[model samples]
Target: MTGTRTQVVVVGGGQAGLAAGYHLRRLGVDFVILDAQSTPGGAWQHGWDTLHLFSPAPYSSLPGRPMPHQPGQVYPDAAHVVAYLSDYEKRYELPVQRPVLVQGIHRDGPLLQVRTDSGTWSAHAVISATGTWWRPFVPAVPGRRLFEGRHLHTVTYRAPADFAGQRVIVVGGGNSGAQIAADLTGHADVTWATARPPRFLADDIDGRALFDTATARRRALDNGQADTAGVAALGDIVAVPPVRAARDAGLLNAVPMFTRLTAPGPQWPDGSITRTDAVIWCTGFRPALAHLAPLHLRDRHGRIATTGTRALDEPRLHLLGYGDWTGPASATLIGVGRPAREAAREIKAILGPGHRPQG
Candidate 1:
């Protein structure tokens, strides 16, 4: 295998990886970002056509560059985000290798070996920023396989046109479910299903507010003070314009999660059946950590215990941008910078003064 060496090897060049690259560059650390995607924009490139941020452009930016504002757009759409990420990658000149599928990370003496389809990278530290977009989580509902109609997850959902004039069921109570259900309101006979009544945040609350709240909560906990409720106190769903409009039109109403799926549709608790033509699951995603399986870091709960972003069992391995476990709101574009900065600093400290960027 072709081999290369670096002081740090960052896995997954999404928002998190790019943020890490920025900080590492600022620290003069020799590192390369490995992205599985063929081009820039990371997971944003794969998002639904109409997907929009809950925040404005400024609040949705990466570490070094602000997302260029879209005229007349209060909440920028997915295309806007993709463009911003692509531009950010170029603007900072981050050392990112694309189309590099990382297969695993194994220990090699004092270094970690990042095995990728392209080649192997030996690094003193490895930052796994592989986000959750690839690992969409679909809850196992009884008789789901027996359903005859089209079934898809949030990852595969593109637009309402595909489900036009069909009876559709959207499952999950989060932002994806709300946005998707709202998108399908006029086009499809849609039923929004959730385990409980969906909670909507105040119209004023957006990504900025959510990040600030999470930061405050993290600070309070760190100082041994009373834990603040954080974003949960506000609500689950952010009432973005489309969702708000749908809610106002009385089309975004959600039903209780069905107990099981029948051939034609779902069976609710009261035995009421909805004859649905398709089911779109917006259930959310798990962290994409398959590459780290060789390290055996995950616990029984499928979580890697960490103090900040560094793995508790393997100090050389740092996990970034997974979610709250890595850092408060670290999964978001604006929120990833803090943890990335910290992780880069820690890696720099570990590498010490002897290691310098290779030419």
Candidate 2:
């Protein structure tokens, strides 16, 4: 019912949205950020208690401010990251409105109309930074609905203590699965399952190295050189401290994915069954873009075609922090900065001289 106007509206006040806000403010763009969460930490607030960054604090920061180092921590944990984000927003006094659930984004003449639970915002450009946490992806494994045991996803997983003494199967070969399985090593009877063998990056490699690798690949492509190997070429898992220790202890071995989910547990391809009390799915997530469905911009491949961060079909809309499709490593804290900067610059160009913030 209520209505507001701004030059730009950034949806989702998470890391990506914050990065965009930093650049837009620097460029004197009159904008506002709407966050679905009530607080400043974004999705980091929901990460499991023991979750930690693969890179050190300085290597994982936004555009204008570096995350403060947590004493006695090489790789900061989830709580530390949340505290840093809370501080970063206040340090810059970024204009952020919280607890506003965006319903949809629609076109209105020359402006984009963002309808939310609290109110509506009309802006020349809109950046959808609503990352994937809200939409956890679980593959439709046959018989999943028939399973009698508890089924959980990475988003809902809190701590290993919750599943103490229970037999659990962790599905997925990615970092989350490895990390969760490691956490549950002593707490639960757990089995790690992946479609293929788990790939671990060199023990010495961390997120900082992976970020650098992605940056190099981007540069090589920009210069018209042959594509270089990226983080994926190195491995899937980052081998964070816990995971490394678990692997070294021989407690983190992964088995092949189950062919089907039985009432009690999972059935292997050979028809052998593993009776389990619960199954935790760390399969991964898709972008949280349901609000953009009204725009119908996604291609047949279920992706929004984009030139850098700007959507190809809808030039006034920009997608940030989705992943490499928006910009190299755009989903990571340090990586999201480049694309956010580029998106802000592009919005400024599109809005032209008249839309600059008033002195």
Candidate 3:
């Protein structure tokens, strides 16, 4: 209930935080993972029931363990991922404390102070792995408030049953949009709105391929070289069964986003109106960096400029698993392990070998 001191304190106990814990444990540092969620599995636990990873078992796993699945099983669903993350937590015995809502973080002389709703923690360094899931971002469009239909972001979306018998518009061109649209097409009259054409990898493509491709592109871009590899981005839709089925059934069509929302529905650029019942926004999220605002590392938006997951200006803080800006493919279950390892080593180098907890 009072301030708990440690050498290192990791905020956000999702995949990125868990991955960082894996490395910090190996580094033999005294640390604790402060999780906002009461349960394990991080943000993955909140995805829709039918949501799935684009990669096979091995590719979707963390650094220490391969995701378990029956022989020949490729993509895993939300439940399996959650179970694996829960089991991974128990298997490693990571020092995790749940339901610890971090309210603010600021530098206190040589140490960083973490103030939480329940208590406080002082650490030599802090790692902010708070992924973007909690901060769903829906872009501002004219007349958005005029729509009388139901509006929901993917964060609250759980299943397709709630949307039955309605004309729905699934907005955004990424995997969530694709999957959610696919799930609803069978039950509702669905229209898809995307800023750009949704690109799909070949049926055989998976997360591993996407990560490799993204890494290649990043490396090339950093070196000022052209991207020779014709690889798609990680955000590009993977043709999962439901999405593929939707594609085959001619229901995966996407139109450019409408100019604005109307009383009845969407108003297109040509002034055409489409009557709609509900809108499910899969537009994505911004980083959850409100707690770090006291640090003065973020910009006008809640975005912190980072040097390979480390704050570009702050020496004692590192961010992980929000997106590529943190590290290559850092947002994925597979991609987070590398950044976690590197960030832990960076902290170890800065804070010395073993740290004794101080109150």
Best candidate, TM-score-wise?
A: 1
Off by over 4 Å in 2: 356-359
Q: Give the backbone clash total of model 3.
A: 0
Candidate with more favorable, higher TM-score: 1 or 3: 1
Clashes of each: 0, 0, 0
**lDDT digits (tens) for residues 1-359 of candidate 1:** 46888899999988999999999999999999999999888898898989999999999988878888899899998888888888888888988998999999999988899999989999999999999999999998999998999999999999999998999999999999999999998899999999999999999999999999999999999999997788988899999999999999988999899999999899999998888899999999999999999999888999999999999999999999998989999999999999999999999999998786342
User: lDDT at 196 for candidate 2?
Assistant: 94
Candidate 2: pairs in clash: none
Q: Is candidate 1 or 2 superior in TM-score?
A: 1
Q: Output the lDDT of residue 4, model 2.
A: 84
TM-score of each: 0.98, 0.97, 0.95
lDDT score, candidate 2, position 188: 96
Per-residue lDDT value at 266 in model 2: 97
Candidate 3 residue pairs in clash (backbone atoms < 3 Å): none
Ranked candidates, highest TM-score first: 1, 2, 3
lDDT of 3 at 37: 98
The RMSD of every model to the true structure, in order and in angstroms, is 1.2, 1.6, 1.8
Model 2, span 51-151: residue lDDT tens: 99999999999998998889999999999999998988998888999889999999998888899998888888999999999999999999999899999
